[model samples]
Target: MPLLSADQLTIQRGDRALLRDFDLRLAAGELLHLRGANGIGKTSLLETLAGLRRPAAGQCRLADEAAGLHWLGHRNGLNLQLSAIDNLRFWCGINGASPAGIDAALAGVELPARARRRACRSLSAGQKRRSALARLLLQPRPVWLLDEPLDGLDAGGLALFAALTQAHLAQGGAVLMTSHQTLPAPLAARELIL
Candidate 1:
């Protein structure tokens, strides 16, 4: 069965229909990229899929329970006063996951040992984004909903992100993300233009 399915989904903002009769299905180990110009509701669609907002019409069905999905939005979603490891630990608690992988997950994001102990507000934009991404490694989920995940990432960070995404796919995880750039080689991503 598909991991996620959206049938005849409609999204609107203030009576301005951003999407209508939109349909999508994502199976395990699949990657789907949402593309369009600015203000085209890419974020809206992702938010709807994440259950952050209600769609104007239609419905989204998830094969697994809602908690089995992960949503990474444009914001880093970190507390400025919290250390990188602490931030991930907090998220792990919320997800009912173990905190044992906190160190390894931070390392996966290329955050230095010293940096991991520093507050999130002290990190650079890319570093902050990486910290947020560490949550993915800390808590393995079947489906990922990412909005502009590549933003603020450096070339090295981008490579790391791609590698992580590929690893997730290899583990039978599905991803639905919005990105203007094409993914790196061998990811086998399908594209949909809004």
Candidate 2:
């Protein structure tokens, strides 16, 4: 079964119709990349799929509601006041994951022990982005909706994301994301241009 299916999806902002008459299906073990110019509603499209917004038209269906989803938007979605470890702890608690994996998740994103203890506000932009990405490893959800997921990453961060995403796909999880950059080599994706 498809992880997510959207039929004739329409996206709008205020009175402006950004995109219309779209269709998409994301299958398990697959990745779909959304390509478009800025300000063309890629974020809105992702929000609609993640169930954060109602589509202007059409509907979206997820194969398993209990399986849940992971959403990474343009913002890192970190609490600047909290340390990386603490932020992940809170996410783990909310997502029904064990806090024990926090250290491993941090390490997966290449965050060092010292930086993990520092406040997110004190970390560099790339570190903050990595901290946010670590949440994806906190729990196993069947679907991930990411918008501009690699916006601030350096080469190492990019490589790290590729490895993490590849693993997720290997486990039959699906991803629908928007990125201007090409997906790392060896990670195949079907693209939809808006």
Please, what are the lDDT tens digits per residue for candidate 1 over residues 107-189?
A: 99998788999999999889999999998888778999998888888888988999999999999999999988777655668
Task: Report the number of the highest-lDDT candidate.
Answer: 2
Worst 10 residues of 1 by lDDT: 180-189
What's the TM-score of each model vs. the native? 0.94, 0.95
Clashes of each: 0, 0
Report the error of model 2 at residue 117, Å: 0.8
Q: 118, model 2: CA deviation in Å?
A: 0.5
Candidate 2 — which residues are off by over 4 angstroms?
none
Whole-model lDDT values for every prediction: 0.90, 0.91
Off by over 4 Å in 1: none
Q: What alpha-carbon RMSD in Å does predicted model 2 have with respect to the real structure?
A: 1.2
Question: After TM-score superposition, what is the CA distance of residue 126 in candidate 1 from its true location, in Å?
Answer: 1.3
Quickly count the clashes in candidate 2: 0
